[model samples]
Target: MEIQNKSAGRLIKLIISGFCIGLIATIGACKKDNIKKEYPQGSNEQINTWILDSLSRYYYWAAELPKKPGLGQSPVAFFSSVKNASDRFSQLYLPNQAGVSSSRSLYGFDYAVIQEPLSLEVLGLVKCVLKGSPAERYGLKRGSYIRKINGKIFSSSNVVALDQELLTGRTIKLTLTELKDGGYIDQPELNMIAGLTFEQPVLHQVIERGGLKIGYVYIDGFSAGMASTLVSVFSGFKSAGVSELVIDLRYNSGGEVSEAAGLCAMVAPGLTYNTDFIIYKGNKNGGQRKESIGEAATFDKRLDFNALLQNNLSLSRVFILATGATASAAEVVINNLKPFMKVTVIGEKTVGKDEASFLISDQRIPKQVDWEMYPIIYKLFNAQGQGGYAGGISPDLELSEFTLLPLVPFGNANDALLSKALDQISAQKVNAGLRSSINEARSVSQIGRILSDSHLAKATQSIVLTHR
Candidate 1:
């Protein structure tokens, strides 16, 4: 009986051991599966190498590049230092960053430029701003002439180069020439310290022509919150029964794609649209695979059409004032709005750069690295599939000449372009026998006379300089 009991006990022990082994094997299988599915496809060793390489590259690039102040720090470290920095970076990397940033700077004259001859000739205006000082606090009024920056004569040819130099967080010395007695006479020399915080977008009113109220919204870069601002401005115009809108995207280097799309949504209204496309390549085994023609292991996702369709705010007429400075997101705005409305494109062709970029960091490699890449993951296409604008968007109503005006930075909208659009809108009203809802016919008649004045002809000549 004792022998039989001992045998039973041994049998039970063997069974328990088998069950333990099976449980461990099952757990191991699940762990392997999770790793395969959760991580981007690669061998364990290879992924480790890639990750390290990416992190190292990111660190090195940040250290070497001429980035914005406080941006050269480690991404991981930056996020750690600032609460919600990750969310900020995610939004910043998008194409709409320029517009968004521009919208944010709308409150103050964070930056200023000298209006060009055409700008002054067309609108009889010149503008500059109190850099690093708020417009209200410094008493830097609009329509002020920037005679010189740091004792150097300011001109259209050198404004861009000078602006770049000033962005280096240095004190800029300026001589102001206020517009008084109908001419620009030199005022006093003023010293201003510039910083990244001083850059802001401006919206200004130009001359009212032909009973039509005109406004100018100058965009320097597309960042976040631009779409909302645009919507608000247009909505205000609609409420006020304003007849025309002039969007000056001149000197605008592109930023966020989503912001561009958002702007398109506001302008185009009810159109079903797809602005961009993403192409993905993968193996049958659901692993990352290389493409023969393009970059390896990438996939494409087009714009969320449903989102855009739902937030539609269509405009009747959109006059895009562009130049060589309009690029990327700006180009996207121009491209997407073509189908839905009468987009009267004016100015020079845009910078042909529709491609998007991504920031990457991986640590599972031989070296820790992080980097940015302008990967052509997606192609931008209109309804017709024609995407290359290397030649830029040609204006439907071409100006006889072009001008380089440095208006009171971007905020002082009382300028030539807005005035011209207002004139055109007023002329349309008179020819069609349609009266504007906001203004009396008498006002319209007076504006018509002002628009037809011989001075306007001279202004037109000065604004449009023929460049072969």
Candidate 2:
């Protein structure tokens, strides 16, 4: 009923990552002289030339860029033509175009359309409600199930269509069912507008397990300010005298690499500014480059690694909670920190997005180039040269969050995944794990599947190298 999105000036700071280096550095700046505008300014041919220049220089598969390509097609079509057949994350955005889309439209919550194990009725289950978004303000609690959308019931056949409509919609009306005193109860119809500015969904707390105090934090997504946010949380964990830590990234699809690296440094033991973080592999023009923690730290102003280290748990081992939704920058934390510590991943396998991108556009004043490109520019490898999880990283202990229905919120002992992680920490040993990487997608007929988690969702959610 209340309008929250109308006043959102900086929209979706939560969804998209990396702000200080806000994609202002032009990928084509150095080679602008080499690129001559064959057509008039803002013309299709000229715009295509800019796109070509960017891809040719920075695209991971730059060698595949067409030399004698047609320039007459629209920019979007043109981008598709030249991109490598293997590239999945590349995207081109029109000016002011990315801002208004459903992706940026702050629905303020994320949900999974799951099938009731017995009744087999498809229902929309709220996975997480952004800390201060419209959904949370609407009294929509995590673990609540949606029975109807605008009075229409959910079925496998209609769930997918309804989700699409829900995303594109401005005002979303939903009838949700939640776990009450002991059973599910119908709540009143709730209406939310997808217009709030982005707010990162980061929640933290300290839990006592036996004699050890454990610091548990749920990181939903990574962005520019994410590191500084962690700095504060870790500072508290230090104050709490917590001995063990659990990072709940079950719903994080990832954002900026800088933010990801910041998290790595925050928890890993004996890490310094110069610690090797990532090795980037690209085509001819984009030669291989390695970045250290110090180098990656510079991209974000809020990431005070020194402060984070002061608050660091200094654990020799860690437990990371993941799922199919965990990927890109999120995967970076799991992969890159392995050498420095024993990283045990729990929950379902990750959505192996083994690549990172450069946010490309014309950074000139009164910009001549009107489109923005988020092309997969680098194959991200950790310090040990461990890359290529195209299928996803298998969990040391594989467990599905949807294994049980009417899920409780994160950090709740009733949560299957989080509970298992706590059990592992108590026993101080990981259970025999499964290494299978097959898709965890439920049966198509059983539940309407939405391409919600990682494994690609347009662009904008990946490990982006936004600045020089």
RMSD vs true structure, all candidates: 15.8, 18.1
lDDT of 2 by residue, 247-304 (tens): 9987777888888887887788888888888998888877889888867865556656
CA shift at 240, candidate 1, in angstroms?
Answer: 3.4
For each candidate, what TM-score against the reference? 0.51, 0.82
Over the stretch 1-468, how does candidate 1's per-residue lDDT look in tens digits? 999999999999999999999999999999987663343344333343333333333322222322222333443333333222211112112232343222013323433342433224112122323344433344555444456756776565665555444433345565666444445567677666433444444463443556665545666556655554565555555556555567777555666665565556645645544333222221222222212111110112233344444444456777877655467667766776665677777765655654344444333465333332222223344444556554556666554112222232343332334434544666643222322231211211112111111212111111100000
Best by TM-score: 2
Task: Give the range of the ten consecutive residues with the poorest summed lDDT in model 2.
Answer: 434-443
Indicate the TM-score of model 2: 0.82
Clashes of each: 70, 3
